[model samples]
Target: MAVEYHGFRVTVDAKADATDTQWLCRAVLEGVEAQSETAKLPCIELAIPKLKIDVLMALSMVEQTAKQAIDEWWHARQPEMA
Candidate 1:
Protein backbone atom coordinates (compact mmCIF):
# COMPACT_ATOMS: atom_id res chain seq x y z
CA MET A 1 0.00 0.00 0.00
CA ALA A 2 1.00 3.63 -0.50
CA VAL A 3 -0.07 7.07 0.63
CA GLU A 4 0.76 10.62 -0.27
CA TYR A 5 1.37 13.12 2.52
CA HIS A 6 2.07 16.80 2.28
CA GLY A 7 3.35 15.94 -1.20
CA PHE A 8 5.43 12.90 -0.29
CA ARG A 9 4.21 9.51 -1.49
CA VAL A 10 4.97 6.68 0.90
CA THR A 11 4.97 3.11 -0.43
CA VAL A 12 5.81 -0.33 0.89
CA ASP A 13 7.40 -3.41 -0.67
CA ALA A 14 6.12 -6.10 1.62
CA LYS A 15 7.44 -8.83 -0.59
CA ALA A 16 10.43 -7.48 -2.39
CA ASP A 17 12.12 -9.73 -4.93
CA ALA A 18 15.57 -8.40 -4.18
CA THR A 19 18.21 -11.10 -3.71
CA ASP A 20 19.59 -9.49 -0.57
CA THR A 21 18.30 -7.52 2.38
CA GLN A 22 20.95 -4.88 1.94
CA TRP A 23 19.90 -4.32 -1.64
CA LEU A 24 16.26 -4.18 -0.63
CA CYS A 25 16.95 -1.69 2.09
CA ARG A 26 19.08 0.41 -0.19
CA ALA A 27 16.40 0.43 -2.85
CA VAL A 28 13.72 1.35 -0.35
CA LEU A 29 15.76 4.19 1.11
CA GLU A 30 16.54 5.58 -2.30
CA GLY A 31 12.97 5.21 -3.47
CA VAL A 32 11.53 6.98 -0.43
CA GLU A 33 14.15 9.72 -0.56
CA ALA A 34 13.48 10.28 -4.22
CA GLN A 35 9.76 10.52 -3.61
CA SER A 36 10.27 12.92 -0.73
CA GLU A 37 12.58 15.17 -2.68
CA THR A 38 10.38 15.21 -5.74
CA ALA A 39 7.45 16.14 -3.50
CA LYS A 40 9.36 19.13 -2.06
CA LEU A 41 9.41 17.55 1.37
CA PRO A 42 13.09 16.90 1.87
CA CYS A 43 12.78 16.29 5.58
CA ILE A 44 10.08 13.75 4.98
CA GLU A 45 12.76 11.26 4.01
CA LEU A 46 13.99 11.40 7.58
CA ALA A 47 10.71 9.86 8.67
CA ILE A 48 11.23 6.74 6.54
CA PRO A 49 13.46 3.81 7.39
CA LYS A 50 14.48 0.36 6.10
CA LEU A 51 13.37 -1.55 9.17
CA LYS A 52 10.24 -3.63 8.69
CA ILE A 53 8.45 -2.69 11.88
CA ASP A 54 9.46 0.92 11.55
CA VAL A 55 8.26 0.92 7.97
CA LEU A 56 4.88 -0.49 8.99
CA MET A 57 4.34 2.10 11.66
CA ALA A 58 5.54 4.93 9.49
CA LEU A 59 3.33 3.73 6.66
CA SER A 60 0.28 3.72 8.88
CA MET A 61 1.00 7.12 10.32
CA VAL A 62 1.67 8.58 6.91
CA GLU A 63 -1.56 7.04 5.58
CA GLN A 64 -3.60 8.65 8.33
CA THR A 65 -1.75 11.93 8.06
CA ALA A 66 -2.08 11.94 4.27
CA LYS A 67 -5.82 11.41 4.49
CA GLN A 68 -6.15 14.37 6.80
CA ALA A 69 -3.82 16.55 4.80
CA ILE A 70 -5.58 15.80 1.56
CA ASP A 71 -8.97 16.45 3.09
CA GLU A 72 -7.78 19.77 4.47
CA TRP A 73 -5.89 20.87 1.38
CA TRP A 74 -8.66 20.09 -1.04
CA HIS A 75 -11.35 21.34 1.25
CA ALA A 76 -9.63 24.69 1.48
CA ARG A 77 -9.26 24.84 -2.28
CA GLN A 78 -12.87 23.86 -3.09
CA PRO A 79 -15.06 23.86 -0.03
CA GLU A 80 -18.26 23.73 -2.07
CA MET A 81 -17.04 20.77 -4.10
CA ALA A 82 -16.08 18.82 -1.04
Candidate 2:
Protein backbone atom coordinates (compact mmCIF):
# COMPACT_ATOMS: atom_id res chain seq x y z
CA MET A 1 0.00 0.00 0.00
CA ALA A 2 1.11 3.57 -0.77
CA VAL A 3 0.17 6.91 0.67
CA GLU A 4 1.28 10.51 0.33
CA TYR A 5 2.62 12.33 3.36
CA HIS A 6 4.54 15.59 3.75
CA GLY A 7 5.06 15.94 -0.01
CA PHE A 8 6.51 12.47 -0.21
CA ARG A 9 5.29 9.00 -1.12
CA VAL A 10 5.37 6.21 1.43
CA THR A 11 5.03 2.64 0.22
CA VAL A 12 4.60 -0.15 2.74
CA ASP A 13 5.47 -3.80 2.26
CA ALA A 14 4.30 -6.35 4.81
CA LYS A 15 4.58 -10.10 4.83
CA ALA A 16 4.84 -13.07 7.07
CA ASP A 17 8.28 -14.19 8.19
CA ALA A 18 9.90 -17.40 7.03
CA THR A 19 8.15 -19.51 9.62
CA ASP A 20 4.86 -17.77 8.92
CA THR A 21 4.44 -17.04 12.59
CA GLN A 22 5.02 -13.30 12.62
CA TRP A 23 4.53 -10.39 10.27
CA LEU A 24 7.34 -8.06 9.20
CA CYS A 25 7.03 -4.71 7.52
CA ARG A 26 9.14 -2.17 5.70
CA ALA A 27 8.46 1.19 4.22
CA VAL A 28 9.93 3.00 1.22
CA LEU A 29 9.90 6.77 1.17
CA GLU A 30 10.41 8.84 -1.96
CA GLY A 31 10.49 12.58 -2.40
CA VAL A 32 7.76 13.82 -4.71
CA GLU A 33 7.04 17.24 -6.10
CA ALA A 34 3.60 18.50 -5.31
CA GLN A 35 2.94 20.25 -8.62
CA SER A 36 4.10 17.55 -11.04
CA GLU A 37 4.01 14.58 -8.69
CA THR A 38 7.50 13.52 -9.83
CA ALA A 39 10.20 12.00 -7.73
CA LYS A 40 12.82 14.47 -6.49
CA LEU A 41 15.18 12.28 -4.50
CA PRO A 42 16.34 8.75 -4.09
CA CYS A 43 14.12 6.35 -2.22
CA ILE A 44 14.65 5.85 1.51
CA GLU A 45 13.84 2.43 2.92
CA LEU A 46 13.03 1.91 6.60
CA ALA A 47 12.59 -1.35 8.43
CA ILE A 48 9.81 -1.11 10.96
CA PRO A 49 10.63 -2.89 14.21
CA LYS A 50 7.14 -4.14 14.86
CA LEU A 51 6.11 -7.78 14.94
CA LYS A 52 2.52 -8.86 15.13
CA ILE A 53 0.41 -11.98 14.68
CA ASP A 54 -2.33 -10.22 12.75
CA VAL A 55 -1.72 -8.65 9.34
CA LEU A 56 -4.11 -5.77 9.96
CA MET A 57 -2.34 -4.77 13.16
CA ALA A 58 1.02 -5.02 11.46
CA LEU A 59 -0.11 -2.79 8.62
CA SER A 60 -1.39 -0.17 11.04
CA MET A 61 1.90 -0.13 12.88
CA VAL A 62 3.84 0.19 9.64
CA GLU A 63 1.75 3.13 8.50
CA GLN A 64 2.18 4.96 11.79
CA THR A 65 5.89 4.29 11.87
CA ALA A 66 6.30 5.50 8.29
CA LYS A 67 4.52 8.73 9.06
CA GLN A 68 6.77 9.38 12.05
CA ALA A 69 9.82 8.67 9.93
CA ILE A 70 8.64 11.13 7.33
CA ASP A 71 8.08 13.76 9.99
CA GLU A 72 11.58 13.33 11.39
CA TRP A 73 13.09 13.42 7.93
CA TRP A 74 11.32 16.65 7.14
CA HIS A 75 12.32 18.25 10.44
CA ALA A 76 15.97 17.34 9.98
CA ARG A 77 16.12 19.24 6.70
CA GLN A 78 14.78 22.46 8.10
CA PRO A 79 16.80 25.33 9.56
CA GLU A 80 16.67 25.68 13.30
CA MET A 81 15.46 28.85 14.92
CA ALA A 82 17.92 30.87 16.89
Candidate 3:
Protein backbone atom coordinates (compact mmCIF):
# COMPACT_ATOMS: atom_id res chain seq x y z
CA MET A 1 0.00 0.00 0.00
CA ALA A 2 1.06 3.61 -0.60
CA VAL A 3 0.09 7.21 -0.73
CA GLU A 4 1.18 9.94 -3.08
CA TYR A 5 1.17 13.60 -2.15
CA HIS A 6 2.43 16.54 -4.16
CA GLY A 7 4.08 14.25 -6.67
CA PHE A 8 5.82 12.32 -3.92
CA ARG A 9 5.10 8.70 -3.16
CA VAL A 10 5.05 6.94 0.20
CA THR A 11 4.90 3.17 0.19
CA VAL A 12 4.30 0.63 2.96
CA ASP A 13 4.68 -3.14 3.24
CA ALA A 14 4.74 -5.69 6.02
CA LYS A 15 6.92 -8.73 6.53
CA ALA A 16 6.87 -11.59 9.02
CA ASP A 17 8.41 -14.91 9.78
CA ALA A 18 6.18 -17.94 10.00
CA THR A 19 7.83 -19.08 13.19
CA ASP A 20 7.17 -15.84 14.97
CA THR A 21 4.15 -13.57 15.36
CA GLN A 22 6.21 -10.38 15.20
CA TRP A 23 6.31 -8.35 12.02
CA LEU A 24 7.85 -5.25 10.59
CA CYS A 25 6.94 -2.53 8.19
CA ARG A 26 9.05 -1.25 5.32
CA ALA A 27 8.35 2.09 3.76
CA VAL A 28 9.83 4.41 1.15
CA LEU A 29 9.29 7.93 -0.04
CA GLU A 30 10.12 8.84 -3.60
CA GLY A 31 10.44 12.39 -4.79
CA VAL A 32 12.77 15.17 -5.87
CA GLU A 33 14.74 17.86 -4.08
CA ALA A 34 16.37 21.26 -4.67
CA GLN A 35 19.95 20.42 -5.56
CA SER A 36 20.91 21.96 -8.88
CA GLU A 37 19.87 24.57 -11.38
CA THR A 38 17.44 22.16 -12.99
CA ALA A 39 15.03 19.73 -11.29
CA LYS A 40 15.37 16.19 -10.03
CA LEU A 41 12.39 13.83 -10.24
CA PRO A 42 11.62 10.59 -8.45
CA CYS A 43 11.97 7.32 -8.20
CA ILE A 44 14.63 8.97 -6.13
CA GLU A 45 14.09 6.58 -3.27
CA LEU A 46 14.30 7.19 0.48
CA ALA A 47 13.55 4.06 2.43
CA ILE A 48 12.80 3.50 6.09
CA PRO A 49 14.41 0.68 7.96
CA LYS A 50 12.13 -2.12 9.04
CA LEU A 51 9.91 -1.14 11.94
CA LYS A 52 9.19 -3.76 14.55
CA ILE A 53 5.47 -4.16 15.13
CA ASP A 54 2.62 -6.59 14.83
CA VAL A 55 1.11 -7.38 11.43
CA LEU A 56 -2.31 -6.09 12.39
CA MET A 57 -0.90 -2.87 13.79
CA ALA A 58 1.15 -2.27 10.69
CA LEU A 59 -1.82 -2.87 8.45
CA SER A 60 -4.10 -0.64 10.49
CA MET A 61 -1.63 2.20 10.53
CA VAL A 62 -1.11 2.02 6.79
CA GLU A 63 -4.84 1.85 6.11
CA GLN A 64 -5.71 4.78 8.35
CA THR A 65 -2.94 6.95 7.04
CA ALA A 66 -3.81 6.17 3.44
CA LYS A 67 -7.44 7.01 4.05
CA GLN A 68 -6.53 10.32 5.66
CA ALA A 69 -4.24 11.16 2.81
CA ILE A 70 -6.89 10.32 0.28
CA ASP A 71 -9.43 12.44 2.06
CA GLU A 72 -7.11 15.41 2.13
CA TRP A 73 -6.23 14.97 -1.50
CA TRP A 74 -9.87 14.75 -2.45
CA HIS A 75 -10.78 17.88 -0.52
CA ALA A 76 -8.00 19.81 -2.14
CA ARG A 77 -9.60 19.26 -5.51
CA GLN A 78 -13.09 20.30 -4.47
CA PRO A 79 -12.63 23.92 -5.49
CA GLU A 80 -11.36 22.99 -8.94
CA MET A 81 -14.40 20.81 -9.57
CA ALA A 82 -16.82 23.64 -8.87
Candidate 1 lDDT tens digits, 19-80: 42321211121123442454321112224434444555655554555455545644675689
- Pick the lDDT winner: 2
Candidate 3 lDDT (Cα, whole model)?
0.49
Please give the distance, in angstroms, between residue 11's alpha carbon in candidate 1 and its true position after superposition: 4.4
Q: Residue by residue across 1-82, what tens digits does model 2's lDDT show?
A: 8998888787877876677666667777777866325534434433333342466667677777778876765676664821
Name the lDDT value of residue 57 in candidate 2.
67
**Number of the top TM-score candidate:** 2
Q: What's model 3's lDDT at 16?
A: 60
What lDDT does each candidate get?
Answer: 0.41, 0.65, 0.49
Residue 37, model 3: lDDT of 18
Arrange candidates by lDDT, descending: 2, 3, 1
Comparing 1 and 3 on TM-score, the stronger one: 3
| Backbone clash count, each prediction separately | 0, 0, 0
RMSD of each: 9.0, 4.2, 8.7
What is the overall TM-score of model 3 with all chains considered together? 0.39
Query: Worst ten-residue run, lDDT, model 3?
Result: 39-48
